[model samples]
Target chain A: MSDDIGQKKGLTRRGFLKSAGGVAAVAGMAAGGVAVGARDGLAAAGSMPKKWDQGYDVVVIGTGFAGLAAAIEAKNAGASVVVIDKMPVHGGNSIINGGDFCAPGTRLQKAAGVQDSPDLMYKDMMKAGLYLNNPELARILADNAGGALEWCEDYVGAKFTRLNFHGGHSVKRANQTVNASGSELVNKMLAKAKGLGVEVKTRTKMERMIANKDGRVVGVEVKTGYRYPDEKTGKTAYIKAGKAVILTSGGFSNDITLRQIQDPRLTEKFGSTNQPGATGEALLAACMAGAMDVQMDWIQLGPWTSPDEKGFGHVPLFCERLVGYGPMIDPATGKRFFKETGNRKERADAIILIGHPVIIMGDSYAVPKQVFPRALEKGLENGAIKKFDSLEALAKNYNIPLEAFQKEISRWNSFVEKKKDDDFGCMIFPEARPTVTPPFYAARLWPKVHHTMGGLVIDKNAQVFGFNLKPLKGLYAAGEVTGGIHGAVRLGGVAMADCIVFGRIAGKNAAKETAWG
Target chain B: MTRKHGNIRFSPGWLFAAALAFGVLLVYIGTPYAAPKQVASAKAGDCAACHGQEKVFSPSHPDTKAMSYKDCLGCHAKGGPQMLQGKLPGSHLHQLRGVTCEKCHGKVAKPEAVEEKLCRTCHNAEKLVEKTAKVKPENPHTSPHYGTSLDCTLCHRQHAKSENYCNQCHKFNFVVP
Candidate 1:
């Protein structure tokens, strides 16, 4: 009976002899013809079979901005590309992202009368990243961001309809998409990728990269028809990558265990804004295949999220717009807290130290003029954002001492009148007004795991570097999967730029690789 | 000792036992049926057609052997003593409404999963959005973010308990079915 079961599973004689615990390992060996110890004995790619279950010139593993961008570029470069995603949905976090593409100098910036340059943008990144950023990679992103944004606008046909400001940027450089969601760009990219005959197969997950005896990633072992978060759902198969394999499987923000290993403070107590599939399995698979990782402890937390909401809820849309124009108060103290315009890490850390949710509030003037109407309405509808008729009422709603809160509001109003923040040094926008308006809006602020600043180490050309300190041939990575561009911290809206820029580079370079087969 | 050793050698008796054991193992692991048989002439109360004589409902409920959707609605109104809309899977509702399994799945050896387009054939997404515009918190069919293109299966699973897909990212307590 056991022997029949072994035959049904396509297990070899040796595989059948192994214990049930060794089934998975024996299965890989059966297909690759490399025993467990023999694999480590080889200096490079192990001795595997010549035949493959499937073949593609370039296999891209992800369907987010980075993966789609890579697929489109590789296909355009004349490579027969196939993009695979483990999720049932095509886009990962990119689809749900807030659609802020930061570029140094773009038409949107120009139309908004904002003076910005790539040099200045690079400076802001370096400052926020604590100068730990790889200068070469950061330089590449800064220089090419505008060109990439233009490509997304002109070539991909994704419209950037508005210029917005992110906390760490020097100017209003974030080009907001038409729908204010990354879907506007991701859907367009998906359409373009499909139009170019780039086959995108969802529910197909890469189990591991297959390297030859020379340590070059030649292909990948994948499970087709895989359902995400269900380890037992897919049937294993080997796919031959004729040229290269691109890993753009994004970050580990949603990976609590992995993130806690890197930054112990990031426990499951903190929620993430990423998709459920935004775990570390794919990135760790690359590491198991000899890929190097760097600065993995540097995870970013978004301070704009609300405890009252889920995932990256509409509170972010409300809070981001109100920052620099309103005050974030520690409800416990009923007074102002950290600089509202502080970078993501500082603000999140400060809120954690406070040990309770904070309140970010804006008046009718700021709420109407600054916040997106849809977001404000939705936030209110969800009961995360509340509108109060008076300053006392707002304070009472959040259980803030009315006397202290009123005094703080008066102080904040004085700062607005003087165009200076006397206390926490929040960036005060020129259009700011006092909080004396009849209707006041507020949302309780808390931190949610937002982005990972570390991943696979790659060079400026997007070729992944191996643990052996050599470029892993036939391997490339881009977007959130590859790190060192953001270094210690990734500023807001820079992810879109990073993904688009490096995705194109990885795609073009991957296609240029000599086909091993 | 020699005889005992000889008894352990390959023999037709032992081989027959091994083959029989293997057959039993195959039956244990393999599915008994290829797919659920969908008879076009089957009635709503024909439990034996698909489920055999297994008791699927509580004993306290009226005998459903010959009951249709209208008969069930007599006791289980939209929001009455027993509402089945949110209580049962969408396929059960279809079955009760006289929508045979072959209607949506068609006559096939094995039925495949249906897409949102299949649901839209009967229920228009745009009209759903307009109809539910006044739903207290907000409309579920359309949104400022995804608009009306969200797959119906995300919230209207036929074979399983329906879920509010928006709850993954928002605090919308929508009673989806």
Candidate 2:
């Protein structure tokens, strides 16, 4: 949920839980139009906006990691910025995430002495992404990733806590947020904007891009009327630009049609981690103006993101942080998908469908809280797992699977059975033991799109492209909008890195151009 | 079966292909090999006159009244409220760029006086979906869309944003990019 707009969901226990920036996103779209004095001028004169205001050197669309990064960097660069959102809330999914997850050069990485290099990082990621990435973007991503993490810690006030997800990569890149998940990062960005004299406009929807005769961007027409200030009247107005437009909109994971089109099987089965504002407006506009789209076919696979509900699609994943470190058991095949390979696309896709027999079992507090009770009853009733008064009884439930699970149990049972993963490589290891004592438990998990790899293409300079593969003048793109940066699939902590790295680049360069012809 | 256009049949099966075909048809339609139009629209005169009333920023300002079709930008720059909604510089969709309001809105002295049917008359091709794209789109009465007062260029990014909007413009994007 965006700090701009959030609501109390049923997860009130999760603390005044918020919708994923719905209101803030709407304001971004609406206010963006109003700020631009959008022709069709920002909701036809007096429209209600939550936080609408006008004028800026740059208009950064979307408020997730990319947009947030762009806004912060642009303001720091001395250009007035208006960070607009279609979601009523501003934080987006970045806020609801487990903060202290993983990243290199992170304090956690230094402490662990994992012994790594950016080249090694890039090589490993390329292996993970199957080498389907633009070399330049990948190198840049790996080289500066650590600094970006540091920027978050230093600028965004992200507190560093180390956790071993074992999902992807080496070293501990997932850094924990000292505050509430990643809201600290989002808040830090908002605070930075306030400091930089940037305009924060929400509830604005991007209506259209007004370009000049030479096809250079002149302004953007946005729709208003929800709840914002400093917007144009009902008549379309123009917010001329001195530089480029940066779109940081997130992927269309929640869009049903988009999901189906991207991958019918995944969308048909497991729901993706997309919020409502993950609509295609900004992305499509960039493409219509001639940006090339890349690698859209790949989907991020996460077994838990899909919950217990079963139709063609509707799954839930228990919170990763709350679940802690646990071994996911495949019930259908009665084996582990190795361990912590969920973050690796190949590793995830290879074993996810080996018959949905996966049950994540862990020590200490790995037993899932929200759905644990129901899952325990279901496991015993259906015989997917056997409930035992002791570990022996649990063993009988897995007689055929004992040989498989035994390895997992013994590996973590020792004080240092395996600090460095020999199988599926994960830098940090979970502290808990596999011994479930008297009470053994397990829960269901499903794999699906955790993120999107497809987006608009850009040159090394980050200029937006046309149909002929030529850069569109006065048009620049970055963040998730620029594909080929992450290879075919993304590394876990790479999203934040990509956002910061390219967002800074795009903003710096975009600011140099004049929007008006 | 309802006819797609004049002779083409409109059926659910061929609707998509028909839309694409029509989008291609829009590339070259009944016109004098229009690389450019002399009098793009009859209303160009009125738009240039009144656009200065709002926030005078149309690209064609000072020489707007005196210049030919090309020099309108001298007096009126591109931000005037009237000029923006009226699509002064042009529509993102090239076909609608140079055309005057009279071509689609009709040549009546007042825009409202023109029969809405005149818009539908040529715009009935919208059922095909692809043909609905226009450089100078008709009034919503002819092909209803949201945020009408706003320029389609301002918000509606031409490329597929993601697969989600395919539901809204199913014909435009059968495949999610």
Candidate 3:
């Protein structure tokens, strides 16, 4: 039964005949961790920040989880710390993220008698991230799953009541709360910061790092942020750092310019789910700080698409899926980009099958019932889609090829309705699968720039990697700003886990800094 | 400056002299009396009094709110708080909103009946104004945080210490408002 289960899960038939304890490791990785780049060791990117201002003990850049964690640590260790962020709020994307912690072999999961191990978790993560994630980070995440979970629950007030998500978890280790809101997580992190006497300043945009003669990172040059009315008068403040700098600003999922630079097709077609401030300035900053970069070509996508570019803004994955019905499609072809699957990851693989999408298709049945009507209404509402009683009428309404539409529907029916899709190898098809229904529908959506894979690479200690192949003296980075996490491709939920885990590490390391001068 | 007085004899000579002085003041700055307009005038004073600290949970906040820099610097020299009680009141807290005593406490001492009379003018209670603080509690500080006959400013740093200082050790069960 165990061997059969392994095969069913697509585990390699030949792996370590390790003990049941090792299953925890394998399962944990499988549950919610991705490991890539385990072969040849990573080389150094060779850039460093020198000390500058004398006022601060530790200066953190980017206000996401990484920056916050570092600042909290630095402050508690009897050093004055200043956290600088480009956004109006702290915790960057972490605050806006769904509270589904993908920790494997956690105390919570174990307490529930759920059998899980770090090895399995690692293996699963490697698979989900498609072997593009860093193996070291993936292993650590699996190992510390229990400790991280306990910290999240005890210190940071994460309710973690709900522990389920459809991302990269094999077991139910993704911790969410009752209300299932990101604000709940953000609010808790903020509260925990206060309990530890950490000073938080919002609207304080960090421009760059201040380095001394030796090029040691000293302070961050910040401007009086968004809420500060007189942004023009720009308060030029420099909070000193005695030990290190951590950056956690989010990725460039929404930056039209960055998206265009990375993937123009994605920018022009599929829209972003990130906030308005989803620019990749942090990427630029890290590069200027001497970090090597990669993975600019990769990005994450969701099934939810709209005729009007700004689709459902900032909806959580599952929340939107609840009402989001049907497959997305190309209004021109009335076909689909990939084998239509209910599973989003499989759907992603299908979308990227070709360098470009052949077609985008979906019906009212396949999409969430609530989402279906809403999407159709939005398209028709926005004049992007036309509604008709029949496929011929629909084709004529939108100037689509009537015969082509008929043929496409027949093909969809053959594979979908008649269950003859063995040729196309499409996944399960319910009533919503085929477009053969009386009134068929179609819309156009292309991929867009979803994320930047390049970030400030870090060691197991979460210390910034220098060009010299050693960890930078006192610099650390976490969150989207630090890459080598989701190696070649990033799974949907891995990004959030990276933010929390690495953010905590950056904070703990920065907390132990000494006033050098 | 206008003179504070019960009577002012409006003479043509006096009015002419005032006009001449005002004209000279304006010319010295190379501009007409622009009324110190919003375009150029620096809006200074109490930056924290209006903008309280913004928490991730809370809305926007003031930068220098803990120990009202305006209150302290209103009399002292200039600048935000450097150090008052060895420990600098850490970052700004939005939780400081509920209480009303810190505005005039800490670093400087003030009497209570004097404090009560001062308080009642804005929040006037006919019979309640005359009652003792210990006998009849009014504010958060009135709940034993202000012991017997002690100076109000002894522990409270209006713009320095957070109003939720007592909350340091106490777990507050927030009934979601």
Leading candidate by lDDT? 1
In the range A285-346, model 3's lDDT, one tens digit per residue, is: 44544445556666666654433334333122222342222334444565544544444545
Shift of residue A417 alpha carbon in model 2, Å: 13
lDDT of model 3 at position A270 = 56
Q: After aligning candidate 3 to the native by TM-score, how far in Å is the CA of A499 from where it should be? A: 1.7
Interface RMSD in angstroms for candidate 1: 7.4
- C-alpha local distance difference test of each model: 0.84, 0.54, 0.52
What local lDDT score does residue A59 receive in model 2, on the 0 to 100 scale?
78
In candidate 1, list every pair of residues with a backbone clash: A44-A215, A45-A211, A45-A212, A45-A213, A45-A215
Off by over 4 Å in 3: A1-54, A106-114, A165-172, A226-233, A258-270, A307-328, A342-398, A418-420, A429-444, B1-177
Candidate 3 lDDT for residue A49:
30
In order, the B-chain TM-scores come to 0.73, 0.25, 0.19
User: Ranking under lDDT, best-scoring first?
Assistant: 1, 2, 3
Window of ten residues with lowest summed lDDT in model 2 chain A: A1-10
Give candidate 2 regions above 4 Å deviation.
A1-55, A100-103, A106-108, A155-158, A161-166, A226-239, A309-343, A347-358, A362-437, A515-517, B1-177
**lDDT digits (tens) for residues A308-367 of candidate 2:** 432112123232432335555565444545545344464456555473535555543444
User: Which one wins by lDDT: 1 or 2?
Assistant: 1
